[model samples]
Target chain A: MNINRNNYEAYFISYIENELNNTQRKAVEDFVAMNPDLKNELELFGATKLEADEKIIFADKESLLQKNSTKIIAWKWNINVWASAAILLLLLGVGWWMMNQSAVKSHQFSEEKINVKSDSVKSSELRIRNSELIKTEKHYLAKNNFAKTKRVENKNFNAKIILPETIDTAELPNSWTSRKKWNEEHEIHVVQEIKPEEILQVQKNVAEIDTIKAVAQNAISVPPTKKTEEKMIAQIPFKTSKNERQILKMLAWASSKVLGKETNNGNFDVSIGFAEISHKQALQDN
Target chain B: MTINDYNFCVTAYADHLFRFIFKHTQHEENARDVVQNAFEILWKKRDEVEMEKAKSFLFSVAYKNKIDQFRKQSKVNLVDEFSAQTKIINEHKSGLKDALEKALNTLPDIQKSCVLLRDYEGYDYKEIGEILNLNESQVKVYIFRARQSLKNYLVSIETVL
Candidate 1:
């Protein structure tokens, strides 16, 4: 644009602002030189440019600086401490797993196969059908020629456990609901039939044994504290077949013990099909 | 930016930053507070900000802080005071430098910012716009108006002298 009087103010402002190129700057300079009257206006424009004062320093420059933060980032733990903590955590984890497994195994008690074998001597079978353990299921030997059968009455059971002499593994119920159902339905009756047969004559066959203890009638005492009494069953010498051995194994898995160490002196006069034997019964010497 | 780069900024730009803020606030303490706060924020965000952009980042933060302070105190117009100072200066016939300084003080807040950023920092129009959050045209207009006001003040003083 031409530097005329009307538009000189805009050119002058641009000139002082350093916004004009060399050509525009030289034009404005020449325009002022030609008309000495405009020189005063150019001088006013020049005075408008403010210079930065370097003397005005921020006194505390050190305050604005940041440290490298090396001190706060330091970790005091050694390698041994870290390794010890890791090992402790691992041990705690394994212990918790083992305890959980044991608890899970106990719930599946009824799922184990029942022990069934024929006895040569005339004996009766007892079934405490309630899935829940009976606080008291009396097994007392008669002083005379008698067989006593005590039935623990349980009603409102819907599931029955499948019981037989021999069972197919494939046909066995797999689900816990079905197993729990079987246990609930087949719930009742304890029949102990001990004929004038000796205890030695009876086969050591477990139908659904959790325990077997010899209790004499005259020797009735306080209720046994132990839910499981392994020492109660008389150690009668009886030969076991493959099926019987399997039954013993299932009994061992159930009771955590298969054979009894203790023996009673009195001979039984009746046949017996007993389960959950509590050896806490009184021992009578014949 | 590294701590060294940040420290460098502190040593290099702190004085200019203080000067820029001090001119606007006119309160040395408030200006110092704004500068300190701006540096703290810059240090905190140093990882995100590039080394080249650190200067602009600091000025932007300080500018926003100054605006917040202005809003808290309301628009502090010194027109009456400026006129009184101008009257006193005319009577005394102050030096050109002193007269120009007083003329700069009498400008509008935005005009002062535009002119200070342009002349003090030697920033081009676009850079001024980025720092002050204004368009290039707005910055140019502000600068033009500021220069005109300063020159007019100077001319009147020159006439008196």
Candidate 2:
């Protein structure tokens, strides 16, 4: 369209709306440049268009959706927090249980050590008693002249007896001759002189023997023949007879005397044998 | 699009659609309902809607719902008329911007919608035509008439001031 004064308003409005074609836009621009008075009107129209746009703003969606959006966020946050707390609690429980188990194990270990030490001490005392009993048995065999006589009477008797070779018999004091004389004179006296403590020690030895028998029975894979059991019993010459009882009492008294001297001021001199007469008297008392 | 893409669309275009509807309806509740309904429709057809076309789809749905709202009311909304009257009464006290707003209210609903789509959203005439269910030329005519009304209001205000 031609941009004359009458048509300029339509072209200027179209130009402001960006509706004018290039030729129409040029025509409008030329007319506006020539008439500077129309420029202020165009500026006012542009400002009004901008202001009208500013007036019709949409409500902020972030503010509008704040309640729902925050709720969703809080729900997710709560799940995360709870999950973390649960894992932490589980770890703490596992740690506490492991610590308690270790403490119990250590306590048990210490108790085992104390029991082992006491067992070793008991075993040592039993060794000393065993050595004394073997010595007493040898003396009874010699005095009664049974070692040679029993071999002929019991044809199944084995001459070889298995003794712990660890104990040196030569280290024992030569009080066996006087012990025989004391026995001949006071065989009954020895049984009467046996102390209660010695009797308790004998009972402990009996219990230990029973335990060993039980362990052996559990360890054996096969049952022994009746003949083998009989042979095993016949090999041991020590029977539960009156003479064997007297022998046990005499051995107990001798062990007590030896242990008493050793315990007193810790003196363990084995050669003195106290006095041969006092030994004879102890045998008489036995 | 996936549900994720639909959710993205809601966050991205919800405010823009709401603004367009709110400007057309001049009622906050109606605009919110229209935007929400538009999103619901988008979600229902999410499998068919593409991510790039989501903005156009949302605006189209919101615009249709806004038109339906205007049809449902049938009677002219006195709120807009009252606001325009108050704006004109206070025209001398306000700037050319206030006068232009009053003039915008004076235009036909279709013209006002087309002009706003053109000026405010910076949509081309063809795009505005698509949104308002008009041809490109028709969109151009609505915008030109709307701007002419605005310019006249500004001049009258300036002469009064």
Fraction of native Cα contacts reproduced by each candidate? 0.69, 0.26
- Candidate 2 residue runs with Cα over 4 Å from true position: A19-26, A48-286, B71-93
Candidate DockQ values, in order, are 0.33, 0.13
**Measured by TM-score, how close is model 2 to the native structure?**
0.43
A65-120 per-residue lDDT for model 1 (tens digits)? 88776554443344567778989999988865654444344223322322222110
Comparing to the true complex, what docking class would candidate 2 get? incorrect
Candidate maximizing TM-score: 1
Clashes of 1: 17
For candidate 2, what's the TM-score of chain A, rounded to 2 decimals? 0.20
Give RMSD to native, each candidate.
16.6, 24.9
Q: List the residue pairs that clash in candidate 2.
A: A189-A286, A190-A286
Candidate 2 chain A lDDT trough over 10 residues, lowest sum: A119-128
Runs in model 1 lying further than 4 Å from the true structure? A75-286, B71-94
